[model samples]
Target: NNFIPFYFFVDVYHEGLQYYVIRSIGGNLILLLPVGLLFPLLFKKLNNVKRILLTGFFISLFIELAQLSISVYIRSVYRSFDVDDLILNTLGTVIGYWLFFILSMFYKRVTYRFKSNTSINIE
Candidate 1:
């Protein structure tokens, strides 16, 4: 009997995995946009892994808090204010980050192969 507001844009009863999919891609990018825009000037010296993981954790916390608070405003109050969302969203972000790493690795390898095959100096 969990309550989700009308304006949440996505259906809640579809299962928790729906939220994971939405948050994993759209939410991660939404949350990362500011960090990506700001990182060059704000914290150029920080390591990428630590920055992504730590900020992603905070972003997940923020999402959970937003959901909790907004649901309160609707006064339906049926959703459980559980910590599990925080865990799942943050892990989703981490998974997205890993996906980025894997794609980049493949891109580099493919580009190297293409460049070598064509006798083009990529350096």
Candidate 2:
């Protein structure tokens, strides 16, 4: 095989999809703050964009700070501190905002249909 010896793919010790998905989803949910903050700014008729964007920035900052404490206090033997993870996590929230935009188009269509159907007079 011509594959680079130093570039080996991940070798897993954990088995079963439950562990797989839980880890994946937990990280995603942790990173969802920016979009969560943005939703109200875009559609809730509340929360100005500046406040939401500031909140997202500070939250990501705080998470990076907490990773050290979390490693020490939450799991002493399980994790290492990494700034790259913080960057990736914040980036994931941004990507999720785009996903939210895509989903809302479907939501808008469905809600319009439902509202139109329900507003008809029975007479």
Candidate 1 weakest lDDT stretch, 10 residues: 1-10
lDDT per residue (tens digit) for residues 5-53 in model 1: 3223244425555665565446544544444334433565532656667
Model 1 / residue 80 / CA error / Å: 4.0
Per-residue error at 74 for model 2, in Å?
A: 12
Instruction: Provide the overall lDDT of each model, using Cα atoms, as 2-decimal numbers.
Output: 0.57, 0.54
Q: Which residue pairs overlap in candidate 2's backbone? A: none
Give a tens-digit lDDT track for model 2, residues 41-123: 47664244454444455666676567667777876744444444444455555555556556667889999999988996778
Q: What overall lDDT, based on C-alpha atoms, would model 2 receive against the true structure?
A: 0.54
Q: Given candidate 2, what's the lDDT at residue 41?
A: 48
Off by more than 4 A, model 2? 1-30, 33-54, 69-80, 121-123
- CA deviation > 4 Å runs, candidate 1: 1-47, 120-123
